[model samples]
Target: MTTVYAAASMSLDGYVSGPAEAGFDQLFDWYGNGDVEVTTADPALTMRLREPSAQVFRQLLQETGALVVGRKTFDLTDGWGGRHPIGCPVVVLTHQVPEGWPRPDAPFTFVTDGIEPAVATARQLAGDRLVGVSGGSIARQCLDAELLDEIRIDLVPVLLGGGTPFFDHLRTAPVVLDGPSPVIEGDRVTHLRYRVRR
Candidate 1:
């Protein structure tokens, strides 16, 4: 079965990014704060994570087959240099395909219709593996559409006062979630998984 999950490394105050795209160093410090090394699909970007975080990251990479992200995230990463670190196909939800995209040899798909179609496309690409929805807006849309199965939070201990939240402006408030089961404690972060209760 393919699970639709939204994952992010969020601050204790519930922000994925700080104001004006600042505070990334505080938000993503855990990615390189340890000695355990984990290489991604991109040869140039390798992560040095704590042992526990390394295991969690490896499992995520193995399980996730495709991703659905908002255009802002796509643009912010500069298309991840044409290859996302996850080494999987990416579906970009946007009003228009960005300029100079749809390049050959790039495992990127632009979905202009909406979040549902974008996720459907990702599921097709994912087969029986997991479909990961990224970016706050996209994740919120998935949640509102009842398409998300789980939420994975790499909870970092920091408060960014204000910024982009991991979850916000839900069409349906008070959405219940199951346990933060299999909680893994890592250096400066805690990996928590919550199943969306139907």
Candidate 2:
């Protein structure tokens, strides 16, 4: 079955990004800086800690056929460098499409209607692969609508007192998380996976 999931590297305080912070690059430094530390002298244990997490990320980027993002996120990041890092079709939700935005034939699809329509378009484009919900507001909409299946949160140790939160303005009755299984844990960060019970 096709799944819709949201994945992001977040701070311990639950913010994805903040005005004080530079950008996502600073928040998600663990990916490039080898900030993930395994506490074993054995090379096998170290590889064990790293390999599965790497595989999961590899699969996420390759298997996700479509993505969804919020308008503010789009504008803030400049459409993710004109092409999403996931290398898939991206559905951007906004009230009005930007004037100089890329055409429909481009990698991005600006959806003005609503989140439902944007998700539907992404689902159709995804086919058998997964539909990835990105950006805090966009993901929150999916979660509020009970449309998200899974959530992968990479918890960075930094504390940003104020910023763009990972979960805010949600109107759902106490959603229970299934498993906060440690996908990856280290000195700098920890990646946890949870199933959203419908």
Candidate 3:
């Protein structure tokens, strides 16, 4: 079965990014803090991760066939230079498609309807592989819509008092999760996975 999951590297204070879109170095330190090299679809970007984190990262890259992200994230990364590091098709949820987009060469689908439609498009693209939902707002929407199957967090030991949160503005309160089942400890981060209990 294909799984729809939300994953992000967050600080101890629950921030995915610090004030003014800063602190990514601290939040994503695990990606380059180790000696193991992992290359992505983008030849220019490669991750040097610890053994444990490398294993988890490899699995995510292999399993995720498509990703759903918000317009904010899409703009922030400049559409990931037209090719996301994961090397998968991307579904961008927005009210309007960005200018000069829907390009024939890009494997990106702009869904203006809503998160549900964006996720549905990603599901079709993913086939039997996993559908990854990114960005705090998008994840919250998926949780509220009951479309998320799992949550994975790379918890970094840092205190970013104010920044972007991995989970926020959830309409449904007290959402229960099953387990952080198989916790994998890495150099400066702990990889936690939980099943969203419906």
Q: Estimate the TM-score of every prediction.
A: 0.98, 0.83, 0.98
lDDT of 2: 0.78
Q: Would you list the clashing residue pairs of candidate 3?
A: none
The per-residue C-alpha lDDT of model 1 at residue 83 equals 97
lDDT of each: 0.94, 0.78, 0.94
Across 125-194, the per-residue lDDT of candidate 1 in tens digits comes to 9999999999999999999999999999999898999989989999988999998999999988999999
Off by over 4 Å in 2: 22-26, 35-53
124-180, model 3: which lDDT tens digit per residue? 999999999999999999999999999999999999999888888889979999999
Better of 2 and 3 by lDDT: 3
* lDDT, candidate 2, at 193: 88
Candidate 3 weakest ten by summed lDDT: 164-173
User: Residue-wise lDDT of candidate 2 within 41-140, one digit each (tens)?
Assistant: 2232332225445555566767899998889878877876666666788889999999878665468888999888999999998999999998888888
Consecutive 10-residue window with the lowest summed lDDT within model 2: 40-49
The list of candidate 3 runs beyond 4 A from truth reads none
Q: Which residue pairs collide in model 1, if any?
A: none
